[model samples]
Target chain A: MKPTSKFGVLILVAPAVFIYAFAVLLPFVGTIALSFARWNGFGTPEFAGFDNYIRAFHDTVFVSSFGHMLFYIATTLVVEVAMGLLLAGVISSGRFMGYPRVALFIPVMLPMVVIAVLWGAVFNPDFGAMNAFLSAIGREDWRQVWLGNPATALPAISLVSGWIFAGFYMAIFNAAFARLPQDVIESARLDGANERTLFWRIKVPMIRQVSSVAMLLCITGGIQGFDLFYVMTNGGPYNSTEVPTTYMVKAVFRDMEIGFGSSLSVILTIVGLVIAIFFRKWRSTRQEDVEY
Target chain B: MRIDPKKLRRLLVSVVMTMSVALTSACGSSSEEGDKTLRIAFGSNGSDGQKVWDQAAAKFEADNPGWKVEFQVQNDDLYQTVGLQNLLTSNNAPDVYFEWAGARLVNKVNAGYAADITDLVSSSGLDQQFAEGAFGTTSVDGKVYMVPFTSDVTNVIWYNKDMFAEKGLSAPTTWAEFLTLCEKLKSEGVTPLAVGNKDLWVAGNWIGHLISRSAGESVYDKVMSKQMPMNSPEFVKGLTYLTDLQKGGYVNASANTIPDNEGYNLFLQGSAAMLPIGSWLIGIAQEQAPDINLGWFNLPAIDGGAGSQESIMGVTTGYIVNAKSTKQDKAVEFLKDAFSADLVGAWNAAGFTVVAKSADAGTLDPVTQSMVDLLNSGASIVAPPDTGYDLKMADALNTAIAQVLDGVKTPQEALDEAQAKVETQ
Candidate 1:
């Protein structure tokens, strides 16, 4: 009966496993293979060995986009997680909590394409709402060509990313807060722990695992940012706002250099994986075993 | 009914398979004759040009029985980027598609994406109808790869006639005079040039013009063909000239950020006095700013330059067939009708210049009239660098131009970097 049960379980999972192999694994392997071949998305692919990877290392545009992604990830970590934790704490505190959760999460619910294009208009240097507000506030000098200047473009784009996904991280942290041991929180309050102390000292420490997960999600999302940059600036003003994903698109689709684009993709995947693993290891070392 | 377990399983599987087949067949039946459909893809040229294409598609379908023509109107940027590869590799590739004839077309031909149509043009006598040297870019190793349809002259400075008159300024004929005029306009608190460098290609147009004017036609041709490097002193001089314009307060403050449409619109609204744009602006101006008295002039010659002022920068955008298309003959037939006198007349009426000499140039609006005069007087026509180089190299050059405008790199440094990248490619 035990052997039969194992066989039944195998049969049940076979379809999903086959689909994963066909759809995900197959294309991934194909991409890796094509990364080493010189194919322009047409005709027969020529063997190019490590030439594509070699070229990528020397590519200034690729390097610039990679640097931009690092800046974006750093900002996302600070903005999304920090704002998310604050909102989650306030919402969980039951202060004006009657406001629906959907209101805060609305930006996350909107499609990324919609958010990017909306932000693009908002960031328009002339007649955009951002500059208009600055002028109305008598801060006209503070106004900038947000997505147009090479110096300001990446940071401006990062602000939009943080705005759109802060809500998503808030939802994640809210769920974690809801699952927190109410007995422990109440005990801390009874021990004369103020709301701030409880939130920072006890609640934060208790939800370390959840916060780690949220950070990991934000990191990966920032590293793979494409739609926002593609819609807003298209990595323009001399590729200042470029990221790994947008650069890959330009190489593969725009430039018709499949090998170079695929190589960039592989490098992006490796970078994401390494950062995620490092984060996991770092978080695990600080994690404490808790008993109910 | 009672049944064995294995038999019941087989019966269920068969029933599911039959249902799935029926569902798939229903969806596939509508587009089964998609092969018979002649798909023509073109860059979106406002609504008027789209209507012209639609009419041509209707006329072509009417002329040929048992054939359906589908018009795929795509945004220009998308068509040149992801859309191109997707169309070429798909089973239902466009039978006829728009293409810039030069290194871009050559890249497609080398990759076996473009069909060789040399014999077809010769047998049909289509070559005789086009102007001399019209097929130069479309030809690779003496074999025609595409057919020219639309032609344009770039680097034409479109200025507001009323503003020029109010300011007591005439179009300058030399680079020094142009600088003086710009300075004069600046002193009067007017933005001398409404530029949109955000699009990159808009800036690329100026670079191509300056190079052609500074380096001369012969030298520019050699540079484009890779016989000489792009980091040559002539190119550096051209880059310096462009940088000086930006530094001299001749261009708008928002030049780096504004989209091309907004910049050109500023000129139309009398906010800016001048616009250095291609011939296509004539049509747009005619539609959007009909009341504004618009005037155009060729890019001024550099002081003591080797190039003739008459060496104009231009390009011929045309239609090319898919190499793997099964209905090549039918597609060529559609192209013939698409380029017929009636269709060409419609395009010309819509403010386009057709390459076919027999095609009418319409009533010749003042702007178009100036363009025609300038093109006719050209000693040699040089295709824009963006057209003559592959997209990757062109992108590098565009970036270099932007960096120069941003004052991040000196002219020599930028050109040297761009030339280095091109050489490696």
Candidate 2:
């Protein structure tokens, strides 16, 4: 077969490269430049050097927002990725036959705004479903203003994020499970490997690459998560649930502090990239690849 | 499909040209520079708000042929998020737009977005149509930039009169009496105040006023102007009242979570005995719970309060034409028609407290009439912080209040936090 010419390859890939650069790369470069300026979304932007970055370090709200992001990442990893892995394993073992895959994925299909509205009612301090459920169970002491309390808000938001995305991860894991070598599993089963043992030792290890990817998505998605947090809490109860995005939005749009907002965005992007790179490095062990 | 290099080069060039044309067309605005249609952008008011605008448009169009009115409507949150800062800088800035008075109005003028309408108003004697002091709020640097539309009595104790009567209670007239009334309400197992402070501005406006009364207007002015620190003793003393309300459990447990509408609804549905909101509540109640009877009272007098005891937290909203617009005259005429007898009467019938002294007294309902009477009663209107001063400073102040209200921190500590935020800003 004839090899493609260099110019032909360049011509073919040019559109995709150009679109990527325009959409992602250009804005990223612009944000970095804007991070050093003092702009209020009007008039000319004045160059302020590292003032915004310096301010972010000294500002409690800006620094605390990352703390919220970490909690969000930790909670979502467990609920979404781990829960999905477990649910997939349980289904693959035929123990959870009654729960349909379609039913599980339904929450993932709903729009985020709809989800936020639904959960907002659910966590509403006065007459929300969570409080009602708690009262009905004779656990009135456990009732809480879920989204209002600073202590509970970030966790509650993470739980909502998990509820929406868990089934998505489950779908991914289930598909990966289906493609696993049946002969090895049958061999393990014949050797008196129980369901739990099979899942833990055989299946889980075989899906290392998939698990790595899932964790990567979870981390990056957590860093970028804004909508539910914005709609449900809006970094309120004194900026308790403020992730970088919400604070960025407030600074740029609400406060008209565009320079500070751009700095926050740049910080978020860098954090996302760092986490992705670190995860890739940690997951790139040559021995983890299982040969057929 | 594989092609020769010469043909491929030509193809790529054609594709580039086509893409540029497509992108250019996509970016082109629907309204051209020479368009006869005039734009007036504003946030969502209640359904009746549209009626007033429509009447204004119809009136304006009837008199001025070959011209049309277009409204760019956005939700309140969306409007607040983008606001005039983004709009004025954009290519599609509204020719006429609704704006709040005070710092926001001044900022618009400072940025040259607000057209000076003093000449327009005085020359036509339209300035005489407004109630006394209405123009003051809409003015910046001695130049009127906005035409006063509605003066919102921003924070008032809007009580369910039916609930009060059933409970054998009346509106309190002083701080001590108000606390006793709150205690009585709590003993009666009724939430005294349903505050949705999630937006910060809801109860923040009231708290700002309360603090202003306690701290004195001069101290309040200094702090808001950033001449004095937010964590000053005067501010802390003013916030003590809020903490008292919070610790007393007179406010809803979910005050920090729910939006103002939900809190107002809680009062409207008789779930909560009182809601400290604004004159705007009537507009919302008229739509959702029309038959509900509500009564209004200013913030009760504080003992030894440094400011005027009868002060009320309020702000005016008005429309301004773009400074750069060629249709400035047309926009001003459109604004005049919006305040014309029939249109303003429509506003009053819809329960809005129109700022015009010329608004028909008979058009106002009892509750609205009482509000207008309060204005006439020589009560000082303390502008709410969000619109009346720097938004960031207001936000920091509001956050401090929320922290204290939620049992998250002491008033002094919260104010310190606010001071920290202000310093960073």
Query: Chain B TM-score for each model?
Result: 0.87, 0.92
* True-vs-predicted CA distance for residue A125, candidate 2, Å: 3.0
TM-score quality measure for candidate 2: 0.94
How do the residues B172-280 of candidate 2 rate in per-residue lDDT, one tens digit apiece?
9999999999999989888898998899988789888899999998899899889999999999999999988988999999999998889888888888898898887
Stretches off by above 4 angstroms in model 1 are A1-18, A98-104, A129-141, A289-292, B1-4, B12-41, B44-76, B93-95, B113-116, B321-333, B359-362, B423-425
Best by TM-score: 2
The reply for model 2, stretches above 4 Å from the true place, is A1-18, A98-100, A285-287, B1-12, B18-37
Q: Each model's TM-score, in the order given?
A: 0.89, 0.94
lDDT over C-alpha atoms for residue B309 of model 1:
73
* Global Cα lDDT for candidate 1: 0.80
lDDT of 1 by residue, B58-117 (tens): 887888777889877788888887787787776557878888878888887887878998
Model 2 agreement with the true structure over A46-120: per-residue lDDT tens digits:
999999999988888989999999999999999999999988898888766665777778999999989999999
**How badly does each model clash, as a count of residue pairs?**
1, 0
lDDT of 2: 0.86
**Residue-level lDDT for B412 in candidate 2:** 92
